[model samples]
Target: MDESANKMNKFDVLGSMNLRTKTLLAIGLSAFILIVVVLVSFFIDPTSITTDWSIMNQPPSLEHLFGTDWMGRDMFTRTIKGLGLSVQIGFFASILSSIIAVALAFLSSFNKYLDSFVSWLIDVFLSIPHILLIILISIALGGGAFGVLVGVAFTHWTSLARVLRAEIKRIKTSEFVTISERLGKSKFWIARKQILPLVISQVIVGTILIFPHAIMHEASVTFLGFGLSPHEPAIGIILSESMKYLATGNWWLALFPGLALLILVLLFDIAGENIKKMLDPASAND
Candidate 1:
C-alpha cells in the first residue's frame, strides 16, 4: 500500500510539470534514443547482418525479431544500422546547413544592396523543387554519401537563412544594436556579438527541424538510385532492395525498415517541435 502511494505521488508530480518542462523532457528522450541507436549500430557485429542462404526469407520470430531478407540478412540488424547511418547523415547535414544559413544571414545584414541580392537568392532557391535540386547537385558531385550530404546541406539552408535574415533585420533596429553601431563597432563585430546570440535559439530549432527532411531526402535519393551506394547498409538501399522481393509476399523486407524509418523521422520532428515550443516566448507560460 505504501509503495503504491509513492508511485502515485511520482505520477502526480510528472502530471504537474508545465508544458515547457515536458517539452525539455521530450527533447532529452528523443536525443537519448537517437544516441542509443547510433551507438548500437556502431557496436553491432557485422556477421549478425551478413547474408546466410539457409536462413533467407525467414519471418519474424524469437531468433530473428524483424525477420530475414531475401538474402538472409537480418532485417532487424540492417534496419538498426540503416537508421544509425541515416541519423549520422542527417545530423551532419543539418549542422552544415545551419552554418550556411548563419553565414548568409549575416552577409545579408551588411547593406541594402547585399540584403536585396541575398533575399533574391533565397527566393530563387526556394522557387526550385528541393528534390529536383538535390538530385541535380548530387549527380553533379558524383553521387555518393558526400554528394548526398552536399546536396542536402546546400538545399536545406534557404528557409533557415530567410528566418535568420528576418531576425537579424529586427535585431539591427533594436536599441542595443543601434547603440553598438554608433559606438564605432564594426558590422562583423556587431553581428557576431549582438545579433548572433539573439538568433541562436532559432538556429538550433531550425537545425533540429531540418534533420527529418535531411533523412527523408537522403533515403528518397538513395531509393531512386542517386544517393548512397547500393553496397551501403543505408535505409534507402535496404528499402530499394526490398522492393524486388516485396511482390513475392516478403512483406517484412520493406515493412519493418520503412516503419522504423518513419518512427525515427517522427521522433526528430517531435523533438524539433517541442524544442521550438520551449524556446518560443509566446508559448512560455503555456
Candidate 2:
C-alpha cells in the first residue's frame, strides 16, 4: 500500500508539470536514445557480422536476437550499423540544408527582387517530388553515399529556407534593426548582430525535423539501388535483399530492420516537435 501510494504521488507530480518541462524531458530522452544507438554502432566490428553458412536462415531466438539472414549475418548488427550510417548522413545533410537555408534567407533580406526570387525558387523546388529529385541527383552523382548526401541536402532546404526568409523579413522591420541601419551598421553586421540570434532556434528545430526525411529518403533510394552500394551494410540493402527470401518464410529479414528504421525516424521526429514547442514563445509557457 505504501509503494502504491508513492507511485501514485509520483504520477501526480509528473502530471502537474507544465508543458515546457515535459517537452524538455521528451527531447532529452530522445536525444539520449539516439546517441546510445550511434555509440553502440561504433563499437561493433564489421567482421563479426560476416556471413556464416552454418547458421543461415535461422529464426529469432536468444542465440540470434533478430535472427540470421540467408547470408547467416546477424540482422541486429546490420541494422545497428545501417542506422548509424543513416544517422551520420542525416546529420550532415540536415546541417548543409540549414546552411543553405540561412544563406538564401539572408540574401532575401537584401532587397525585394531577391526576396521574390528566393520565394520563387522555394516554390519551384517544393513542386517537384522529393524522392524523384533525390533519385535523379543520386544517379547523376555516381550513385553512392556522397551522391545520396548531396541529393538529400539540396532537396530538403526549400521548406527551411522559406521559413527563415519570412522570419528575417519580419525581423528587418523591428525597431532595433531600423536603429542599427540608421547608425550606419552594414547589412552583414545587422544580420549577424540582430537577426541570427533570433532565428537560430527555428533553424535548430528545422534541422532536427529534416533528419527523419533525410534518413527515409536515403534508405528509399538505396533500397531502389540508386543510393548506397550493395556491399554496404545499409538498412536499405538489408531490406532489398530480404524481399527475395520472404517468400521462403524468412520473415525476420525485413521485419526487424524496418522496425529499427521506423523507430529511429520517430525518435528524431519526437525530439524535433518537442524542441520546437520548448523554444516557441507562444507555447513555451504552456
Candidate 3:
C-alpha cells in the first residue's frame, strides 16, 4: 500500500507537468512585455504639452522622448498610446477571428456542401491582398479604429479557418472519435469528450500565430490613413502623420513607433514559436 501510494504521487506530478510548460513560458514573456508597456503608457501625458512655437517637428530631448509632432503634441506619449491601441486591436481581433474560424471549421463537420463553400471562401480571401482589403474595409467602415477592427477581423480569419478545418477533419477520424460514433454518442458528446480535448491545443497554437499577422496588417492600414484616426494616437496614424515632418530632421516620430511595432510583432512571433513547440508532442515530451 505504501509503495502504491508513492507510485501514484509520482505519476500525479508528472501528469501535471506533462503539458504546456513551453507555452506558459512564451505567454509569460509576452504578458510581461504587454504589462510593462501598459503601465508605462499610463504615466505619459495624454494631451498636448508643447506650445505653438514648439510645433511641427521638434527633435528628441529631455522632455520630449520621441520628439514633438507637427501639431506640437508630445510624440512620445502619442506613440505609447498608439501602441496600447494596437495591442488592444490585435488581442480582440485575434480572439474574434479564432472563434469564427473554429466555428466555421466545426460547422463543416456537418455538411459537405458547407465545407466546400467555406474552403472556397477561404481561398478567395487568401488570393486577395490583405492590405488592400483592409483599406477598402476601413473606408467602408467610416475609418479609424472601428475600421481597423472591421478590416482586421474581416481579413484575419481565412487562414485560421483553413487551419481549423484541417484540425477538425483530422480529429474526426481519430480512434476515439470513431469509437464514440459506434457507441451512438451524440455529436456534441463526441466533440466535447474527444474532439475538443485533442484539437484544442492546435487551435491555441494557431491563435498565437495569428496575432502577429493581425497587428502587422492593422499597422499597415492605419499608416495608409484608413485605420485609427490621426489624433487618436495609434502607431500607424503616428507614422502616417510623421511624413509631413520627415524633412525637419526629427526622425524619432516615425522611427520610435515603427520600432515599437517591430518589437510587438517580434514578441508575438516568439510567443507563437514557443507555442508550436509545446503543442508538438514530440517536442513537448522532451
Candidate 3's clash total is 1
Cα lDDT listed for each candidate: 0.93, 0.94, 0.80
Candidate with maximal TM-score: 2
Q: What is the C-alpha RMSD of each candidate to the true structure, in Å?
A: 2.0, 1.2, 8.2
Clashes of each: 0, 0, 1
Error of 1 at 110 (Å): 0.5
lDDT of 1 by residue, 141-259 (tens): 99999999999999999999999999899989999988988899999899888888899999999999999999999999999999998888999999999899988999988999999
Runs in model 1 deviating more than 4 A are: 1-11, 45-48
lDDT of 2 by residue, 1-286 (tens): 9999999999999999899889889989999999999999888887778999999999999988999999888888999999999999999999999999999999999988998999999999999999999999998999889999999999999999998998998999999999999999999999998999999999999999999999999999999999999988899999999999999999999999999999999999999999989888999988
TM-score on alpha carbons, each prediction: 0.94, 0.97, 0.85
**Residue ranges of candidate 2 with Cα displaced over 4 Å:** none
The lowest-lDDT stretch of 10 consecutive residues in candidate 2 is 41-50
Model 3 TM-score, all chains together: 0.85
Q: State residue 94's C-alpha deviation in candidate 3, in Å.
A: 0.6
Which portions of model 3 miss their true places by more than 4 Å? 1-27, 42-45, 48-52
List the candidates ranked by lDDT, beginning with the highest: 2, 1, 3
